[model samples]
Target: MDAQEKIAQILQRLETGTCTPQELQWLQDWYDNQPALPMHTFRDEAHKQQLKTGMLQHIHAQLEPPVHVPVVRMRYGWQIAAAVLAGVAGICGWWFLNNWQPRHKMILVQVGTGQQKELLLPDSSRVWLNAGATMEYPQEFSDVRTVKLDGEAFFDIKQDEHHPFEVHTGQINVQVLGTSFDVKAYATLDETQVTVKTGMVKVLHEQKGLDVLSANDQLTFSRSAQQYMKSKVSNQQISEWAGGMISLSQAGFAELALTLENQYGVRIRFNPAEMKQDEYTLRCSKQLTITEVLDLISSIHPVQYDIKDKDITIHRKN
Candidate 1:
């Protein structure tokens, strides 16, 4: 690749938290070797200075924190060199870095209510995001394979034993070499859950190892109680949501309410009452409308529901 192409690749890897030590050193060296140019080389000083500042700001804004990739330091007098090169090199340097490099920046995907999306990560892993879920990843992944998650998603990670894959939910971290799993860690919920469908995974909290789990293993961490529960889950139970189905067993009102809110994008409110059912069993299609789901749910219990716009209310029936 040409210098511009190589630089773009390096920057992409940097943006994705995958830049290697050698590539980083090369970037530093490239900046260090820029020939100093006199101020008069540029057409206008004020205009050049303004453009330079804007370009740097834009580049920095597109980058993740320096903790992932060290910030490239510009040598003294490099500003004039940059301005002159950008003007004389037919938009080869700074201009190219700003415009052409954006293709490699961080990317965010969000699914709204009553919708779902499937995506392929740079590492060839597949992800299915449920409604009201959001995930952020890079346009390309290099040495590191990682993504940030919120809400719920099912991941089929590609294998790269040398570079383990990681999913970050604010409360916990899931790491795997190659695995298919489902993660539920919606910010509005009181617990985060991980259910493995294949291979193995390690779950951590606050940078400390919590537990290592294998296929058919489920780990639930309660945010409020700061406790962990380990259980066995069926493959159907783990992959049902991805198949547009909702299956619950012995689930309480809060769990059911959150599921409805996520799938339907509605705010749910319950009256003050005992909301737990000893025989709480629910199975339905996510294709059902909010009203239909409510109807089905109420038929199994003595409860009433009302829907107004995006808000839903559930109360015990007398």
Candidate 2:
């Protein structure tokens, strides 16, 4: 095979979860043969089962050959049961081939409304996406660990000293060697919030070419101000979004309103005076409806609201 075709074969193996160390030489061979080829294109579940463990049998069947082959006897001499299970495993193997073909799946996981999802990346990293959040990644990571995220996600990244993970969101670029962190970058909001939970993070503002973030730090990049602010973080406030709670400590009234609008998909207006405030603190549950939040605000402060269709509202709530 030509260099290109050979490299393509190695890539296919890498993507299909079948590549072995012996194949490393194949990759090097492809590279060595690159002089004769074109430049390049940069590229690239758990179950429990026992007896009545149909899932395992199904998975096993998927690897069986089309033609019948000689089989070994079971140590327990349960040939009858083994035969039945083998047939089931065979059918499963076919089902996997036809329906579950890996064909380079770009897996994206997300959550909406009162839902949440936990995902395990091919690199053994973990991600928890909050409601109205999403993560897009490949079925297998290449030389680099790259992902695109929107809304909010908590990442417990796997330590990879060699290749750091990069998170691309809205207008911010976050890179990390290995750390647990949270990011909130919804388009509806005017700012993207990055909070470092452990280790260090580097936040880059793509527009202005600024990088800001480190261990135990909180960073906010504002679209309106076109500025970056860094401060020692009180992690709890920044990470509340991942817990289905919005805790805005020292958040401006306008910022608070913006967060509410984005999370609930509603536009709210506070009596002009409220918007003029420099800041305010709010701790509200994500599960609460906008009306409930407003009601709570009304009880605590001299506030009233004109709710209309749960879509838009004029509020005097403090």
Candidate 3:
């Protein structure tokens, strides 16, 4: 067989997890000797990266068993590199496929009200799904690492320089190679926000605009105004929710209510319309129960709350 054909066979064995160590070494040597191909060999730069990422991830998976790490403790750069390697691996496999078949199996992770969940992707990327959030991803990421998110999440992505990790929300798309960031894009909210804690993130709003953010940078896109605002925040602690802490600075009552509902699994109703204008700056620890939180809020604001089962009603104090 020709060299190209031989390399293809080796890659097939790798994919099936059947490649002998000798075969793997030969494949590696052959790859090292090959000339640098044009980027156009794949559909786009992103696709090219995805292929590289996939290959690297496959290699690692073969060489080492998966290591389970807390989502918050994962190494940011390594996660990104792993994602990029996956892309490269995918490209290598795709090039040899005579007839490609799509993988239809998908995985959906949903966090119920007042609950949070942690997920580990096949590529070793970690995701923390906040309360009342849902994430949809493929059982196995092939070329690219892409996920659809509704509500909020904090991602500690595995690094692969070639592939980009993309999180799609209703109002915006957050893309990164390897980064730690929080994305809040609930459908009910008028604004979608992305906060970067480490590395860099690219936030896209279709044809409207795009914003690239670095550590401690935040981007907010207003769906109603179709405008984006960028700011540097001193408190990167917003992501602390993943660790059972809630911090807010001059946040409006509506936001506070939503947060409480999500974190406590309660339905909160504010009466007479004026409560929406109420704002507060506060911090709550996980030790505080939902009732305690409401009590704390009522102590500061001119409001009283009545809790009945899972429902809460707040009214302006007379």
Best by lDDT: 1
For model 2, what is the error of residue 230's alpha carbon versus the real structure, in angstroms, after optimal superposition?
A: 0.6
Between prediction 1 and prediction 2, the one with superior TM-score is 1
lDDT of 2: 0.65
Off by over 4 Å in 2: 1-104, 207-209, 252-278, 286-289, 299-303
Evaluation by TM-score, superior candidate among 2 and 3: 3
Give the least accurate 10-residue stretch of model 3, judged by summed lDDT.
69-78
For each candidate in turn, give its C-alpha RMSD to the true structure in angstroms. Answer: 9.3, 14.6, 16.5
Query: In model 1, where do residues sit more than 4 Å from their true spots?
Result: 1-104, 272-279
True-structure lDDT of candidate 3: 0.76
**C-alpha lDDT score of every prediction, in listed order:** 0.76, 0.65, 0.76
lDDT of 2 by residue, 61-155 (tens): 43332456554422332333344343333333432343334424688887765566788888999988876787888776655788999887889
Candidate 1, residues 1-318, lDDT tens digits: the string is 656678777656644646554564566567556666444443566656765565444434433346665664433324433443343332334435444545457899999877889999878899999888999987766455889999889999999998789999979999999999999888877789999999999999988988999999999998888889999978778878878888776666887888888787799998535565434568898878889988998898888888899988887787
- Per-residue lDDT of 206 in model 2: 70
Residue 312 of model 1, lDDT score: 88
TM-score of each: 0.69, 0.61, 0.66
